[model samples]
Target: MQAQAFAPRLIAWQALNGRHDLPWQVNDPYRVWLSEIMLQQTQVSSVLEYYPRFVTRFPDVQQLAAAPQEEVLALWSGLGYYSRARNLHRAARMVVDAFGGRFPETREALETLPGVGRSTAAAIAAFAFNARETILDGNVKRVLTRVFGVEGWPGERNVEKALWTLAESLLPEDAASMPAYTQALMDLGATCCTRVRPACTRCPFAADCVAHQQARTAELPAARPKKVQPTRYATLLLACHGGRVLLERRPPAGVWGGLMSLPELPAGELSEAWLAQLGTGEVLPAWPEFVHVFTHFKLVITPQPVEVDALAPRAADDTRQWLTPEAAIEAGVPTPVRRLLEALSSGTLSVSHQIST
Candidate 1:
């Protein structure tokens, strides 16, 4: 298909078949920005549940900027990648301070925000401001890769550069079409050109898609090179006292940053030394070990539930709290931690007999 024909065809298709009722489709950049951040590495269905609640809690840039980071993190709980929420909070304050609570209209200026990257900035600009900016998000990457038959993993620097070039080449000449055009690219890739078992016949690009024509749909977007993922082991201390669990705020960086989590004991740490902070407690049977996979490594977590008569006075500090499982679930805990809390609150804690190596 001619580069000139791409935008018009996509825009037409999107007008009729694209998702139109998403809560964030409003022209307000704040809503657009929130949806964009929440949608990162998250499914639309998940965002559908969180986005409305988020907007209802913090309606605008000024409101989000003024809200406490803890509230922001709490609202963002269960949405993995807590850094996005942290950056979002920081970015909201930055926008309030730097731009008088208004989102920058241009993509270049928008990229300067904490969590808003190139594609995010472009989408915000195009959808919110009708700016003619090209977006090369994951969906667009997949679409371009298969339709153009681009070889090599998109994560590779050189391959990404080529995809960006192709993306820029297909931008709608009219700025007015930017929103529809960008959404079309995303919708096409997400709904039709899925990563697995794509609906080739339903795709508008089926006639011109190199992957479909060449029968290489499965292999067109090359997969990432494999590597042996290393596992890190830790014991999560689920110390219980009077029906409340001891939780600590993780440091503001690294895994589960700035979120409340069960106190962790690394593999080589001494139990007696670690217990010095928590005082004496009766150790219960260990829960079944489970693996939480990160992007680069696997975290082998063993939940060690302990029945403590009382916590050390020093244990309850600004960074630590003893909350009922009900309250902890509502706090900013990681997904795995939340699951454990849910099981504990629901009175379904089953001790696993055989621990995985």
Candidate 2:
């Protein structure tokens, strides 16, 4: 139960059992920072698919900062919680503008960057600078809560504060072991002390874990309280002309922030007005209705495909574009939008009903 004993056991166990080959486990802060941001609210398996492509495209802070936001969002299309991608781009600019294209080496400075929080900052500090700092990320939170039998939801401020205190108390005196110690905590929580069906028998802290001793490993880390998510409606205009479709870039905030998507009609607005605004188009048919659930609400999207004879010329802006269906699919669109566009282009869009408007 002593603070000093925790890190050594974790570090020793990590040497033989921890993940050693993750793409972002290197000593470089840029890679570490990118991985941390991507891993937020996303599983390791999903992050693996995007991490390599992202690094290969951007390479470093300077390149990432210099690249267009659309390109960055395109690379990050499928990964949800898109605000993380936006913040990653914004933070890269901050690092370049303030730190001369170098990632800050200290926890305080790192925390000042967009999307990098306390735990993320500590991780970068420990791995990149070899600084003795503690990280209380989700994995570490689970590990610490179970080992010490901390009772209450980790989201609660008091519980979080206590965990942070415990985390700092358990920091290893030897700075050299920071990386292994940090990674060990993450590995243990993710692979062993999982949220469901934890492998308590193989845990190194089994004998000392208060939750295991009390037969309450499953109940120690309390779950977040659930709330009812309200439903919302949207009408997506799949306006097309010959081989191309109309796509619009969303504002830099809100749902699907900064991503390219099919032009949307305002709530309670008729499809005919929107079609007239764009160009002379005939409203063909309605595609199948689908629902996309966000963290706070459910969106019911009604897809109205309009075949345009001509597109009215408007002042050019970065927010609107007309591209071939294939290119639209390749652009940074939400998953649902991508699916509809793909179906539209391939002549496979299922027609559920005809739209006269």
Candidate 3:
């Protein structure tokens, strides 16, 4: 393969066919970085809805850094992977404190910031600084694997190292072409070289692609080894009083970390201490059980709705709050917690005093 010839072809194809109208296509590093973080494991359609709203709220690094973590989590409520939001907040503060509110220009310098890995730094540098950096994101990995007919799971350390070396070797020599070339690789992978049912006929490299030529597109870029994801269980206390539900802030690190959620208990059981602490309350019939899947395990949640007359003064403190069901849904709650709140607000999961007895 002629390494020098690849960039020009990709650049030309990008000019005519690549995405240009994305909201974050500009030269601003802040917007580029924000879009990249949000785009991680999330679809463009979802980012499109979120990016504008997030930017409008925070506007810049300074604004984001100045905002409270709760506000940040609230804005990122529905977006899975809450840690990204936490890291983004930390990175924003670092940009303000360490870089004097301006993003570092070089990829190496950008990597010092939290959550900015090698590929992410490369993308930020290429897009914002026009630096000649190479990115090997999932899309690019797929494209390279198929184009070169590279075997083995891309997640393997050796395979990833080879892909990185290959990616760096393919970098466009002229720094001026960095943005277009980088975008071209991404656009090609996203639009034409899709994981399933690739549009090989429309691909610029279709004629020369090894996988296309050998009819082994499906076989190359081996899938990750599968394992059975284990399941866990927890019970959420949906204590309601005066049209408000109780919520507790999660610890700083773990599953759904730093987000507000329903107070949890051991599955299939309730704590007598919690009942006594919430003053006189009737533990109504438990709501339907549901499952919230994480990357590592499945969380089977049983929501126990309780109608309390009044809360003890200590029950609702800094760690916990009583907010209207609608307001609680608007808070920094997880998706599953949000669903439960919505159900409570809409009377979809109601329990009467009669139902309790």
Candidate 4:
């Protein structure tokens, strides 16, 4: 199939079938960029819940740029991928400072923003400026690899380069249709050519799709090779005094960056030492071990509660705080940590009712 022929059919199909009413599909670059960043490694359904709230709160680039990072992270608490929130804040500031509070119309300028890669930059250019640029996000990659039967894992450099070339070649000459064309590719993959159980019968490209013809729709876009995710252990100190739990702000990088969490004792360190470091207290019975999985590793968390007469003193520069369970829940703690706090606040946990001497 000629690369030129792909867009017309996609555009026509999108006219009737593509998503036209997503919250961020409007002509605003701020909304488009926000949606794109939130959609990274996240699903449309999930993004839908967060997008409108974010837009209502921030509304525009200038407002988002000026909002405090804690406020932004609080709004983004359950969205996962903490770095996206951080980068979105940084990028908004950059746009305000460097571009005078306007998103750059060109892909090149957009790409310079934090977390805006080539594909994301291209998306903003097409949707916001109607620029004739190609996007090769995961959905597009799946759709193209199946239609064109490009083999090998899309994560590989060579495989990705080939897909990029294919993506660029398929761009329609008429720049006016760029938004529809780009959206068509995304919708086709998301709704029709899905990762599992693709509805090929409903796919617009099924007739000429090489993977369909060869009955290899399941095989063309190779999966990433699997490796065992390593497990790590940590003990979190749930120091409580006057109904408040001790929370520490993690550094603004790495896992759960910039989020408030329970104080952590070093791996393999005794709970006694952490308790002594704070004040005299007895360790409560441990909560059931819980696991939090990251992209590359699994964290086995042991939460130990300590009842203290007074919270430990902190240096003037410390990020630690003692907030009531209600307050901690409102803070930007991760999902699992939030669950623990909620349990404590609700008195559903046995340990919270009984203070160990």
Candidate 5:
């Protein structure tokens, strides 16, 4: 097969072979961007349900921009990587303000928007505007690395640069066919050139794949040495009274920030003084420990569920709230907090809760 004919060949192959039923596949930029954001570090099956519900709630940029941050964060709960939701909302506001409520057309301007990084920008530009920009998402990176036998861990700066160059050079055609070609490349990578157990016999590019030719397909995409994820131990104080739970909004900067969660003691341990700071009375025995894991850190929350008489209600600030258990669920607490509440509602506080940990 001639290199010059690769573009048409791939497109032809994809027109017949590509998966077209994805939630974002109908040539809609808004859906594409939304799905892309959610799909980051998340799988497609997971995003399928989230994508439709989110779009229905906030169908367009303007609607998304206007929705309350708490509601938006609530919708995005459980889809770990909360920053993506925050960035999506922030970018929506910017689009409404700067671009007349429409996502930008070109990759250059789209990249300027919040959360619209290079790969996402390229995807929107190509998939939305038919602009001939190349995307280097994880799937494409693996496909390209394996197809061309590029031997380097893509996490390295130099390796990433080389991969981007390879991606740009591999453009299927010009801007006109970019929408189809972009989708084709992504589809091929996702379904056929997968990380493990690729469908080599069914892949159109198998004959041309250097990794396949050398029987090194599985090893073509070199793995970067794993970094030891740190373990963080913290104490969470869960206080409830009269069917209401006490939660504080995380300051809009740290983990789970801008989202209401069960108030915590100091990062290390729960002390009587900390409970006093919460204006609480005598605390009973400590609740069973629960754990929540994030990308960079693992949190061990030693909870102290204090039964209180009442809590003065107010917005998330230095103060806390006395929300009904169900209302607390709607207030965007972290998964662990929700689990703790579940334990309380179920009258099983002694049971340890493990979530994403």
Candidate 6:
């Protein structure tokens, strides 16, 4: 049988038995878009709880557009990659202002919005607008590269272009089923043609997979190039006054921005006088050391505990808030910051000052 004709049947098999009941699965594009954004650099299990809450808060494009940036950022707290939240907020406003509070009707228009990349745009276009297009997310990329036995690492200019072209070529033109078909491919790639291990026996595309036929399934897509990651050091100041902990909101540009976090690196170096100003007492020596890894860098954080009568301007640009341990947790701090706060509150961790080296 020709590959072209068999493709839909393969996907149909997947649709009937493959696609899981994702939170945004129904015909609601706003929910779909929300889930897709949260799913970036995050997992299904992680996204599950966040997705429903996001939709409940925003519900539609108009609601998201009208929301305050802080509220949006707060809703997006745990999901890292703060820029995605910012962009989603920006895009929502744009959609409301430019598109009459409606999600763009087509992939091209959707792509013009902030944070909506090609695959994301394609998804919105298909699942939302029922456009006949294919989406090549990471899962789809792996599945396509392995099934067709395409070569070269992903993102290589020619290889990526070829993948996109192949993706377009495989998409069924029938508008009625295009949306389901697109999602079906994603479902198959995520569930069956998985990264660590593939379930060939259950995969509908197995019979026609070129790599599988040749016993080269694992070797089809060339391994990606790797580079060494650099490490950086930072200082975090933990302050407590009368059962309240000091938490500062990060600026909206870098990592964990807009989330409530520890007062960090208030100045070039901590001084005894500077410590006396943040709360009711004096600055103590740096005590605990913690290491955390982000996507691009490893951070070694040295925590300093300071007590003062009233929180002051630790630096030219720092604002301080005092809250109970439970209140701080509800204030949108990321995992690392929240974890540290929890440890401090539970007496499992203690406060001190600067690591000499």
Give model 5's TM-score versus the native structure. Answer: 0.63
RMSD in angstroms, candidate 6? Answer: 14.8
Best candidate, lDDT-wise? 3
Rate residue 186 of model 6 by lDDT: 75
Candidate 1 colliding pairs? none
Question: What's the residue-level lDDT of 261 in candidate 6?
Answer: 89
How does residue 118 of candidate 5 score in lDDT?
Answer: 92
TM-score of 3: 0.64
Q: Tell me, what's the RMSD of every candidate?
A: 14.9, 15.3, 15.2, 15.2, 15.1, 14.8
Query: Compared with the true structure, what per-residue lDDT tens digits does model 2 show for residues 113-208?
Result: 988999999999998888888998888889899899999999999999999999999999999999999999899999999988899888999999
What is the per-residue lDDT of model 5 for residues 106-178, given as tens digits with 9 covering 90 to 100? 8899889877899989988888888878989888888888888888899999999999988887786567888
lDDT of 1 by residue, 144-201 (tens): 9988889999999999999989999999999988988988998998888899999988
Model 2 TM-score (2 dp): 0.64
Q: lDDT per residue, candidate 3, 1-357, as tens digits?
A: 677878898899999999999999998999999999998888889999889999999999999999999999999989989999999999999999999999999999999989899999999999999998999999999999998888999999999999999988889989989999999999999999999889999998998899999998887789998777798989999998888888888888988888888998965688888888898988898987777777888788888999999965744346788888888877868888887887788888543322210
Instruction: Give candidate 3 regions above 4 Å deviation.
Output: 228-357
Instruction: Give the CA lDDT, 0 to 100, for residue 166 in model 2.
Output: 91
Backbone clashes for every candidate come to 0, 0, 0, 0, 0, 12
Tens-digit lDDT track for model 4 on 314-337? 757658888998888787788778
Candidate 6 residue runs with Cα over 4 Å from true position? 1-3, 228-357
Error of 5 at 55 (Å): 1.0
246-345: candidate 6 lDDT, tens digit per residue:
8888888898877788867745367566455553576766757767777798777777776656655445544557787779999778776777777778
Q: Candidate 5 regions off by >4 Å?
A: 1-3, 226-357
* Alpha carbon lDDT of each predicted model: 0.88, 0.87, 0.89, 0.87, 0.81, 0.78
Q: Specify the poorest-scoring 10-residue window by lDDT in model 6.
A: 348-357
Provide the TM-score for each candidate, comma-separated.
0.64, 0.64, 0.64, 0.64, 0.63, 0.62
